[model samples]
Target chain A: MSENHINISTNQPFNYCLHLADNSLIMGHRLSEWTGHGPMLEQDIAISNIALDLIGQSRNFYQYAAQLKGEGTTEDSLAYLREANEFKNILLVELPNGDWAKTILKLFFFSTYQYYLYQKLINSSDKQLSAIAEKSLKEVTYHLRWSSEWVIRLGDGTEESNKRIKNALDELWAYTGEMFLPSTYETEYAENNIGVDVSSIKIDWDKKVNEIFEEATLPSPNGEGLGVRSFGKEGNHTQHLQAILKDMQYLQRAYPGCEW
Target chain B: MILEKNISLKKIWQILEQITDPEIPVISIIDLGIVRDVHVDENNVEVFITPTYSGCPAMDMISMNIRMALLQNGFTNVKITQQLSPAWTTDWMTEEGKEKLKVYGIAPPVGKSIDQKYLEELKVECPQCHSKNTKLLSQFGSTACKALYQCQDCKEPFDYFKCH
Candidate 1:
């Protein structure tokens, strides 16, 4: 926020919530692309199931944000009507799912951050946010555990598997900086008890990532660009998000208020 | 208990108990613990329900069924509202529902939502042979609420209702 503590506007709150919802929405869309294509049948079910969970979380946030927005704007409108440049999700989520290893590793990093964030969120003074967090934290625990176990197995299991996971870690490590960086209204929302403390979650995220990487016998990538950060909160995204928006928002845009 | 209400609360409850969860058909919504509160304010009946999981797709169907069931039972103005606070937990599952799940070849959920540290250690008895030797095949299964496990003794694969 620099030296200026900007006044929190009313729309900023829902926009922040939109940020959370967009992250899950895009990540869910990316994960769903793996439907029937997982390396194994059980993993097929697992991955898609995870996609469903993420989408579900997005729905809850979108619904809340819609209510906060008032007027005829709805969760569907928010999800389907938004442009690529309008989305406030972190760039990491908007990135393409390159490979099975890359997908799992990315999910691992995101889930780890979410686990810690939601843990703090459950205690938030905002009762509605707390309730949503309380419900979401349970599912996220499984997501963290599920993805962590896979990361460990791939990183520690065999030479080929370990090599693949190692490559994945190197590729995805840069984007993690975005998760800790607070979005536009995040600082004020946290101060007012209406949002999460993302900065505080970094310590726990580091600890968990280190613990998991150690158990997996894999090296942790040096974060922070020498820890250089990226911005998706500012609507800056990788080239991949536009394509996702094209596909995801297509049905809604083309049909125009059509429902199945 | 009456505030100028024509229908009895007990009657509304019994009628609601007849509505089954769309996915897990063996258990009714009442046994599933989704029905949180049922208030009869004159002719209007407001039913508070909670989702079993964050994204249980059956919630809409469950709501519709509740409305139809009440309407058929002579209660016309029925309202089905969702309550997410105090999130739904497996602890709310009735004893009868657990037994029904076991008999239907799905191991009932074990452990508490708060005591997640014990999740990996929670022993699941095979619903098929009641054997304690069971291995988790996948943390997720056919539905969002279950996990796939294989029984060593019975050599049969079964669904274990995962502790939420």
Candidate 2:
């Protein structure tokens, strides 16, 4: 081994990557549901590509997580073997893709938050965390732009489109809070300068989201009355995640030693 | 002896960069920023790389290319390590690489930078006439990372590398 090599250990940075990767993987799984159901062929391809991108991000993170654990576990083993309660992804990612409108709205909100989160992570003190954030930021930027454009078009287009988009926003608003809550590992990483403070992202997220909403002439979903508590950071997920995990882990679970 | 090793390693690096991405022939794997680190230990040479996308079928080709490139460069003992931490992103593309894409007649990704939210919107400049008067013909283009666009002024269709 080279002198510059560092041992993989159970540290805040490792957990941070795990959390980030898990969020993308779960959300990607949800988005994959819209593969053939998108409103148009072009839209279908776009959403599916996004789903693939997120899954790619998740695979990268999981690979790193396995390295950190220094176990013989591979990415598939970590993703498939983990229990539903063990997943640390935010609730926003696990929500069902209700309709095209709902899916875009979900993407809009989540991508907005991810933009800021990854931006901060790029400057993390931990070299590994910073490197991942730096690389992922490029892909996430496109996701944000793609989703935001859809939100504006759908919200301001036909009356039916407007109504559908608005309803989607209303339904998905309750789950947004979980994105900003700092997990225990996040707190530790922040203190150690290896992770970002999730709360700091709120201002940027609100500003950008508000700008898009205004441009689209859509009313901001009144989250005040929703009163949804954050649960994702603490591994408390919605019922939706259970079903998602069941489907996602099916092949891996059924053929425990299978390799493709 | 140490200086001789460093010189040999540098030669190997140059040979490895000649391997182009199987999918995008215009850009080499090193220019794509997927090649992470290279190390030479005694008689063994190891290259660290990350995949362009997870489950990307092209990775198998990339691994094979590395081995072949090293063997051609006189390094018989070669190993490739795949690192997944810090997922691969387009931001890693070198400025020179972006220019190469433009010269190849494919529009390079345009934007301030990529983040999780709100990527910079780039109007597809005509790859032929360099005009901003372009309209998106379709979101799905030749591949997953491209969008089909037509330049109104030049009346030519081209692919825009969607910022991803």
Candidate 3:
């Protein structure tokens, strides 16, 4: 793995790859925060397992991105060395996990979005991206199912549970719109058929969300005002991302090029 | 040279057969369908393998074990390539491997992974008592490849290797 020097002016495909990789890395890190603090033992293991899967998926994308750059850039440098402002992940994943309800809702929304996105990405013009998407789609399928069930369980459960889940939804709903708003790299690659145009998948995402929300007895948030805090994909992020990067990158920053 | 290459290829396959999954020690890597193909050229050996799951921690260990196994067999120049295009599926798992899993107290995948969001009505018989009256405790288990299941009859908790 090459040491990550600041190459912010890289190609569109490279940026697109980082967008995908950063999403998984941050999402995995957030979920891993629940490893020792899950509500119960079984659920603890379950969420951690999912976190492992996301981290693994992020590794794949980061490795590919490094290979594309080919100037000694490695997955580790790409994951650990990049500045917070250089990250292209959506704001939804970077938000703090408010509670179990919030975490599950975030995962449900992201995975459902990924479900639709990967469904199209599997057919990407780039064979490697296609293969990665194909492999990831299966895992994301299980993620969507697990999170959807949790949403329904929380939304339709006891009165207290229902209230908590509703609060989570209200807190999280504003961030969901950024998922479909195409970043510049995304727009360019999608035109070439090598990347997914997220805007195209918004309808399918809405339909699935509606279906699950209905089953969970939760009202779906209207699409209006969803992107009030958008543009995370353009390297703009909330303050929470800086805090997350502080924890995730502390070791790498303190001990540069250190290996386990 | 041709005869030597064929011999090395066959020997490599046999050596791989001796390497079992690090997590599920009962099933050989070859039987589990992780070892896709092997090729030998002069003294160099290239092995093509696939990951069962993207984040499966066992894959790194499996690669290490393959290297050690090959090194022990005097195949010093060995390379392991990950082929991810045609993603791995449980359908490739050998019948013998499935039997080994059952005997070792873990239920093998029942059938093809439909890869749909909806849960399929797949019946997982308990390896302890051979009863299909088992309930899924969770979609995830001790590892990424297995799910936690408990038998109603024997009341024993076991791992079920999921179809994916």
Please write out the lDDT profile of model 1 over residues A53-120, one tens digit for every residue: 88988898898889887888799999998777678888888888988889999999989988888888
Model 1 collision count? 3
lDDT of 2: 0.79
Candidate 1 TM-score for chain A: 0.93
lDDT of each: 0.85, 0.79, 0.88
Candidate 1 positional error at A160, Å:
1.7
Q: Pairs clashing in candidate 1?
A: A224-A227, A224-A228, A225-A228
Off by over 4 Å in 2: A1-10, A222-226, B1-7, B30-37, B48-60, B71-74, B81-105, B109-132, B138-144, B153-156, B162-164
Docking class of 2: acceptable
Worst 10 residues of 2 chain A by lDDT: A1-10
lDDT, candidate 2, A137-225, per-residue tens? 66677688789899999989999999999898778777777677777778788888888898888879888988999888998654442
Each prediction's total of clashing residue pairs, residues at least 3 apart in sequence or on different chains, is: 3, 3, 3
Question: Model 3 Cα displacement at A172 (Å)?
Answer: 0.7
By lDDT, rank the candidates, best first. 3, 1, 2
Which lDDT value does model 3 have at A182?
Answer: 86
Q: What tens-digit string does per-residue lDDT give for candidate 3 at B1-164?
A: 88888888889989999999989899999889988888888988899998888888899899999999999989999999988878888888999999999999999998786556235757899999999999999998999888899999999999999888
Top model number, lDDT: 3
Clashing pairs in 2: A115-B116, A115-B117, A132-B86
lDDT of 3 by residue, A1-260 (tens): 22223445434378888899999989999999999999988899989998988998898899899989887999998989888888999999999999899999999999999899889999998888888888888888889989999999999999999999999988988888899888778888898998998989999999999999999999867656365645788888899999999998999999998888
